[model samples]
Target chain A: MRKLRYRFSSDEALMLAYRDGDSGAFECLYHRHKDALFTFLYRGCGQPNVVEEVAQETWEAVINAASRYTPSAKFRTWLFQIGRRRMADHWRRVPQQESPLQEAAEPVAPATGPGDEDYTAFEQRVLRAVGELPADQRDALLLREQGFSLADISAITGAASETVKSRLRYGRTQLRAQLGDSL
Target chain B: MSRDTRREQGDALPLPEMNSPPQLDEKILAHARARAPQRRVTSRPGWMSGLAAASVVGIAVMITLPGQDGVHDTLPAPHWEARERTPAALSQPEALQADTLTDDVAQDARVDAQNGTQKDAQKGAQKTEGASLSAAPPKAVAAQSSARQSAGGLREEQARPDAQALERKMQAGASAKKIGRASPQPALNAVAPEAEQSAYRTPESSIERDQEDRDGATHQRMIEKGLETCAALLRSDDRPAAISCYAALRKDCGDCTLPPTLDAALEAQASDSVTSP
Candidate 1:
């Protein structure tokens, strides 16, 4: 759709306008959040098919619920919470599937030194290490990197503040161990 | 372990960049567009509604106010029983004769008061004239006879004239008699046919009047039953049900006279419904 003459001041405003029959406002909101939500889901679940399905379901939920949406919390927090719940539901249905980190981890081929090593291979290793962290720690770290407060992370994950802090601590320690010297 | 180190670790980690396929965006946008709520249409402006209401009232007044001079067309024709039961008679001439008799009797009483005796031959002459006037057209004569019988204690010395001569008396300014003496038949005769011409009647009005006359007693009974139901509902605090009863009553028995309490209840309910959220 072409750009709307009316600019929405915030995600909540856009959602409200969409609720009141302006489909174009929803288009703007969808564009703003689509990529970030996809990234969040993908990092949490390495399978492309699972990422695509969960992302689609999350956005569909947002669309269906636009009429009843209230601005009680930041739109990003709400969106991520939906995405996290979708991912959890998927895991419950498929409990025997390979862990996300194991699914994506490729064996590191031998190289003389870090300087000579492939940058893409190192990036893959880093992604694997991130995926390997316990789910709570990985979620806290992802939310923290996205500039959400610890309180916001706790809300999305349904964890207490202290528990989220401990998870982040353990997640970092384990990641540093796996990515030794290279970090 | 420290906040600074945690910050460094977050900064150093590669944040994944994942974009949904174009197909998913299309699907989501389609769903959103399909599910978008319909916009509310604006209400009619207040001035326009007010103007419409004024026009309706104006039209109603024009329809009802013109033919009021014709008594037979406006009010229901009095039943013979109602006419008979009325304390006063229904012919204007009879009232005039009665008034004339009252004056004569007053004059005689004053004379009698001044002097203790009256002339017998003069009294006999006045009684004969009174009997002569009592011989009027059949309907007027019957009414006068009935009136005289009812008012036997009233002066019997009054003479009554028939309908034809009485109509002349009516046309002659003795017409100033009170409405109590206005008979349905005489009033009908007095009105010009053009004056009797009323506003165009809608089919609904014709049907309403016909059905009303045919089923009037039944409708009154039904309205009484409905009022009982409405009262019961209201007592139970079921306002919506009570309002529904009032609505049905208004539609069905609109012309029937309601008790003031029921009318006030309906009006209060109407206003409350309009003003309540």
Candidate 2:
């Protein structure tokens, strides 16, 4: 509820500490990327509920796995990678119905929470357009928008770096088309 | 038109972004903060810097930190700790003999403590003896017999740190000898009844051994060993050795009752063997 009191170094640093039983570091990490991750999931999967479930599950996996994670992998890369695996698992558990984005775009509900109406509005469109994309293209575009390097994106997607670049090239081109006059 | 105009024009479109809901970040971050894992400062030293490096450097750093430092209590490597921590194997007549000898030595030290004359000498002896004798034999024994219960070898192997090597081994010995693979018995009942009660049954603690945990260890070990052997065989092109080795492991464990997931794991192992270079 209150702002967490932690001087975190980086997301990776925070994850390392959190993995070793540092709750505050985890809180700092959550705050740092909560929106980015939620936006990533919300847009990537197109179900606000699934976004919430997967995001929560992702955090749980990170917590449960603090000790087991390898430091050789980038923290974000690992987190998203785990998130994607969980997403796949979730789908496997339940059948793949249409994502909410295709059926209907979820309106950003007013809450006693963070974010200005302006940014939420901008992100929501980015979110829906993203949902309408093919899984690979959607993930590439979303990762790029969230400031992932192509190499990092490639690692997360388990594709070659060049493949990631092509995904981005194709993804951005699609976004440019889909965003239409907005581009 | 550039991204700016495109974004601006897209702003007015029938897209989801056009509707500005209040406080979405607040809602999401609120959940993130509520559910995020706890984070401690990096007293464990330069960890988590591996995101950008290649695999080798990352593995090196991780290995450098191997288990937790003594202060932290997390293990560095499962193999060493696991072997040291199990006690069921100690009942093998050989290991128990070691335990009995240690028990006598412990009694002698207790007697020396009452006399209060050789306290310093006794403490030093106790420390080394404790390291070599107090904790490990029963562990090696228990780990072998208890393998049937814990499912994920990784979980059991990793979870070994939760139990003191001595107590778990003794407990495993007492239980395994009594139950013979029905349900898992606690692994640390070496000390007197009062001490055992105090150690494992503290208030707010439900530390009963998980039924699933035992099965997990064998799975974990099998998978790890299989993967390691597979990788090695691939590099060496030792086809006959690899297949035979895999078959032997499978046959040995075949009649033994296993967790349901094991069938899938074994199948995966066979598939990997087929596909491996």
Candidate 3:
């Protein structure tokens, strides 16, 4: 985070002060970074529901950690990094869903019977496309599209820089082939 | 930090326009508070007795005072300000009503004067003084008459100041230099640009002051008028928009500004409810 010469105190100290019950510190913190943080979360999740959930979770983590977070690094870097991981985890749990695929195949319960076979076929095709990519590559590619940096991915997955780089490179190449004309 | 990954400044980040989940805020805060460790200490029976004694004396003293000028007013009685400016609110309404209150005050003054003369008459040693004592009530009536006569000289005193203050604040807004309306325009203009902006940032502050002083259907309408103006501003100008929004929220909804997530949550819940039903 960029530090401006605001009257009273430093940002980290103010945050720590807020943890000790100084509401003014929270005011300063929110005013200073809510806009950029929200923007990051919005792009990082792509899904409005997911973005909002991740943002809230990230800020909650910040508030809870304020008493414990060290001044070793910029507060926002740590903050956004939490958002990045939450978004990636969120995607993994729900799976990346596209609107066209949903419309192309109506949702059918297996309990509903064989009348939905056509819908199942469309669903299979979409799933097959995603399944073609290796797991590491698929995650890396998704993270990139979600606006996570190679460094952010590294932090999120706890992967080495070299590993994350290779995964993204291989992932993009494979995704291009799978996506074909769509790419 | 990746090489060749840099894009346009605009593309690097998303601009935040929308709000996040409200439940998440409550959840996080509630969780944090629940997790927060409580400080522990022991209480003694001996100390309890002394503490109770001090509390009793303190409470007794507080109950005895008028509270108009007491230490208990440090934070002010729920809305002392609303009560403080109430006397001035006597000026509102049709002159008939205002005149009624004035007449009430005059009647009290006449009573006081009559009582004084009655005491003087009872103590008088001479018939002349007793006669004069009989004359006291008439003198008070005369005084009341003269006070009514002086109204022509006091019209400016009674009306123009509050109206002018309201106009300066409503029109000048961020330019309102004095937190006060009647503060001369030059003095208001003398307010530094930043200070002036801050002054009108919460126009409702002054309006709140006015409304709190006089809480009747008429004042309520005036508050709603201020709110309508604020909501209109929310639709039109961007200056002071947040304050206007806060004001409208306080006026209409108090502290609950539902997060943008509320609409999504409501939509999600409705879908789920239909499926379950």
lDDT of 1 at B170: 31
Off by over 4 Å in 2: A1-5, A106-126, B1-277
Give each model a TM-score.
0.47, 0.37, 0.30
lDDT of 3 at B224: 42
Weakest 10 consecutive residues, lDDT, candidate 2 chain A? Answer: A105-114
In angstroms, the error of model 3 at A93 is 7.1
Per-residue alpha-carbon lDDT of candidate 3 for residues B140-214, written as tens digits (9 for 90 to 100): 534543454356225323323333444355455543443433221122111222222222222333334335334
- Per-residue lDDT, model 3, residue A125, is 36
Off by over 4 Å in 1: A1-8, A105-117, B1-12, B43-277
Which is the better candidate, 1 or 2, if ranked by DockQ? 1
Which candidate wins on TM-score?
1
| Tens digit of per-residue lDDT, candidate 1, span B41-130 | 678888998999999999999788754443334334332222223335445455435533433333333222233235234445656666
The iRMS of the candidates, in order, is 4.4, 7.0, 9.3
Angstrom error of the Cα, residue A159, model 2: value is 0.8
lDDT score, candidate 1: 0.62
